[model samples]
Target: MKRTNEKIAEQFKTFQILDEEGKVVNEEAMPKLSDDELKELMTRMVYTRILDQRSIALNRQGRLGFYAPTAGQEASQLGSQFALEKEDFILPGYRDVPQLIWHGLPLYKAFLFSRGHYIGNQFPDGVNALSPQIIIGAQYVQTAGVAMGMQKRGQKSVAITYTGDGGTSQGDFYEGMNFAGAFNSPAIFIVQNNRFAISTPVEKQTAADTLAQKAVAAGIEGVQVDGMDVLAVYTVTKEARERAVNGEGPTLIEMLTYRYGPHTMAGDDPTRYRSEELDNEWEKKDPLVRFRKFLEEKGIWSEDEENAVIERAKDEIKAAIKEADNTPKQKVTDLIGNMYETLPANLNEQMEEYKAKESK
Candidate 1:
């Protein structure tokens, strides 16, 4: 008999709705979305790309703090996010700020988050998301707990989380999947396999043929999708969410994608590890270009319309960064206060000391 992971790997072929040129490759897999909805998807992808570009500039100018570039993975980020309802819980990794913003986080707050402001961690009323997790793979376990809570409360919502290829190697990743599987929790796990976990290539991170096949170990549904195709990501995510809410348990989706920049805005360099030849190859499969082509073929999108969206996004991003800059400097006391409902004695003493120092 064949080994289990190999069987699972053979079953989990990469799914695609659109080819590299944005032409439909699988008509049967096309989602039932309206023309307006298709346009909306393109708008989000374009907006995210602009945001990524602006963020890189901000980081260089010292106007922003930590940032992970989302330039090439626009479809993977925005497409999966577009499939969820507002009531659903989002447990995102540090790079997933775009999803949180679209899910109701104010754009200004996202700027604040990257700036390390304490207020950035606070979610507004009715926003069902946690601040982006800085620790890799921690959100996976947290998502399991949040999904379990929703399951127990009989809420018709699912909890979804995303991590990069590097995150899949963490112990927490497997533990979260196992717990969610055992309890039949309503969770959707997405691994954005962008070929690198920082400087480490994904192949070095695991022995499995594909990240999706790891789902077999937990006895859950698994799939690989063309992450550069927005429609494909949206369709697969929607199906996974539906299954989760219906109590069919969790699904692990591996997005075959790439990031077009350094792992972070910090001192790390991508050129050292990734080759220009490889970069050019992925550039041809750029998500925005592919999706825009598809929308153009449908006669629902034009250059003028896309330009208008880009201008609007620039305006929004400018205002948000201004707001973030106007925010009062975060105090040490503020961090401590947000850390606990009731401060422990030692923390209380430190908070009082910081308050006194702040007052002076």
Candidate 2:
């Protein structure tokens, strides 16, 4: 055969409704959101970034542990989660704590979870979020099963899972996406392609051209969006949720974004593998800066408004920290009590022995 190009142009272009300067690129595809609604979206994005900043600082100060920073990925995470209904379920990865909080996980509980406390997994009634998954790509399979269960119960809601570019390489990713397509499960998969799976560049992870196209083999609709553009991500996710609940089956979304910091607070360094030029380039397309520009132009946002939002988020974080600190620490007894429906005599005795020693 002669050297020739295959039919690949159809999926090469990235789908983005908003541009870097906060202008809507496609008017027809623009979401019909009001001024207040738009401000609310920007507020959440700002809040998440601030939260990340504060939490990372806390971790550095030895007050917290095990955090995956979400600084540059606010648009992809918050935008998609904002599109979901309250009844919808979420299966988030370590970096999706912001989305988990939006879905009802309290900020303090998130902090507790980061600190390795069991109470961190606890949530008040009516909250439909799951504990953050540290194991990569596991949420995909879990989401598929949850969606199937919802259908069996005749519920009208859907289940959404998030992963990264590296997660697409996991077998669980394929299994989950394929199961959803085959069974018509109400599951939406969000792949935040932040260009690096930890310190490894995404190009080294796969040669599939785009992470969105990974869904094609599963017979699902896949689209790539500007993950830095909040409007574009929200639009795509909202459409996908509607399609899922309307019995149209699954959709895969690849959000093109970047992570400004390390993969985790523990043992990674961005500067070790990435360059200042690349970081500066991505900094220009920051989700918060672009959205703020648009809202300021629309006369719906101002320096005062932004500062107020920041103050509000900081206050909330402070209150959450206080609440978390005041919470009764998880004891040795809870470990045995929560492990089984009926406690075995030997384990119960051991738990009581430890409890007695602690009381003394």
Candidate 3:
């Protein structure tokens, strides 16, 4: 029997396990995560929180370029990344440092990248992932194409593409979804619905009741999960990837999360639109705090251990910032050289003219 809109809506209400007070509301359905795994998740969550805060500070001090803070969205980011296989490709948006960190990107490398160092583009040898995509919805198309290529090769890997609510408005989003559906490509389009695209709220961004519903038009299944619940995000993403690998086509997952910080280090004034009270309300539901409490209740976390982890993460971030700052600046000629097989006559002449001016 086909389900009605009300029935589907009731079934789709965000999947949640851990409650705000650290209690497992749906303990039976929760994954059998070991004590060690819980500790690891808590540590990663704390590390990400510290890194996000440090990045904001670095931006303010002019040490790094404009950055989007991932403060309140660590659970969704890290949990989704952790659920993937090492061979699976991840296409992360600008606000997904936690995922990159969990994927073994060093703190120094990420910091170097944030500081606009060229070496940041050079992933560790053998790491197939691309640098974070800043052009919003561009990664969606690229990821879909990559997934199609993998399918042709009979590779069992899946490609996970992350984007925001605002990105859903782009034509490329629908195009990528359509291609993935038509080809039955192994890809998962994860929309981290943080409710705002810069200053624009989700209400103004689209008329759709839920981003997940858009997947129906693309001929794929869609699921809405509570992005703040790490376990729920992990489970849903894992299931989606499994389906994709089995030739069930792509899945669109809308992770309902909230970003507590400003959109970027640049001219964004979140305070202009969002109130302090709302920020405080979200803070009470902070993923890190909730997860920490859950771990504590499970006897996997303690104040001393948490404090030690925080101190270590702070030291690591400070060292990475220092190393990134110390790296040599990129040469002016390298920029034009890296982009083309050979510089055209006009570009060559322009470069020479600039060099000559500098020499004078």
Candidate 4:
């Protein structure tokens, strides 16, 4: 007899191994890593936080054109990103800079992207990540196509895509999920449910009780995880990657987390949509803070180590900014040229105009 007792489709439960106070609620369920590995996770979280802060400051200074802040969702993004293979393709949304960086996108290239420079579109030779998709749920469809290609070639490489709670609402989200499911494609879909999709909160976005359940219609497995717990996220994502590479299928993960700042650097006031008290309450469960405490307990982290890591992060970010500054500016003609092998008449005319102007 087929059982229907609390399946993922029937009811999605938030998976968590760690508590807010850095204590393991389920020791067996927690991912076991060496001291060095644990320390790496802590370091990456700190680095991501610093990077997010730096980008926010740069945006405010009019140095960046458009950037999304990924402050409180470090564990959600980084932990999953760490689980992927080097050859895996990453289809990222705008708020997923840390993941993009982890997937071989240089820090400077990401900065250039925020600055609206064309150089950001170019990835390192071996890196398989794409530039962040500005359209909300567009990456979903893109990832599906990529996964389909990987499957046809019988390559172990998979395509992992990320979206927000808002992305789940788009038609592309369903279409992508459905296509992957039908083909049993090698793809992983991650939903970083950071409570708010811009000014609109998740509660208002859908009537569904859990975002993970959305995968049911697509005939794929989905689960909800504590986005604040790096270990839990790493475990789930690593297992998901293995399954995809092994030809099991795609999975949808909904990470329950919060965004501590405004949705974007476009001057949207988070305060107008949410309360200070709510933000303060969520701060108690900050991913970096909790992970740092865990590492300290393992005797792998200390005040000195933490300080050094912070300084290193700052230096790395400084170097990225310098690299971006030193790079040549984006050209109008290049933009028009890169779009297609055969350009339309209007774009050709525009490119010619720019070329003539540049020749002056």
Top lDDT model: 1
Among these predictions, the greatest TM-score belongs to 1
**For each candidate, what is the lDDT?**
0.93, 0.89, 0.84, 0.89
Q: In model 1, which regions exceed 4 Å deviation?
A: 1-7
lDDT for each residue of candidate 4 in 48-74, tens digit (9 for 90 to 100): 898889888888888777988889999
Provide the RMSD of all predictions against the true structure, rounded to 1 decimal: 1.5, 1.8, 2.4, 2.6
Ranked by lDDT, the better of candidates 1 and 4 is 1
Candidate 3 residue-wise lDDT, 1-360, digit = tens = 235544555545677887777678887758767888878888888888888888888888888885889988988898888788888888888887668767777777887778666687777754557788999888889889989988999999898989999899999899999999999999999999988887898989876678888888899889898888888888888889899899899999999889988888788889998888988878888898888888777777899998998999999988988888788776666566666798899889877876776567
Compute the lDDT for candidate 1: 0.93
Off by over 4 Å in 4: 1-10
In model 1, what are the clashing residue pairs, if there are any?
A: none
Report how far off residue 307 is in candidate 4 (Å): 1.1
TM-score of 4: 0.95
Tens-place lDDT per residue, model 2, 208-264, is 677887887899988999999999999999999989888999999999999889999
Cα lDDT of model 1 by residue, 1-360, tens digit: 348657767898999999999999999999999999999989988988899999999999999999999888989999999999989999999999999988999999999899999888888999999999999999999999999999999999999999999999999999999999999999999999999898998879887889998998999999999999999999999999999999999999999999998899889889999999999999999999998889999899999999999999999999999999899999898889988999999999999999999999
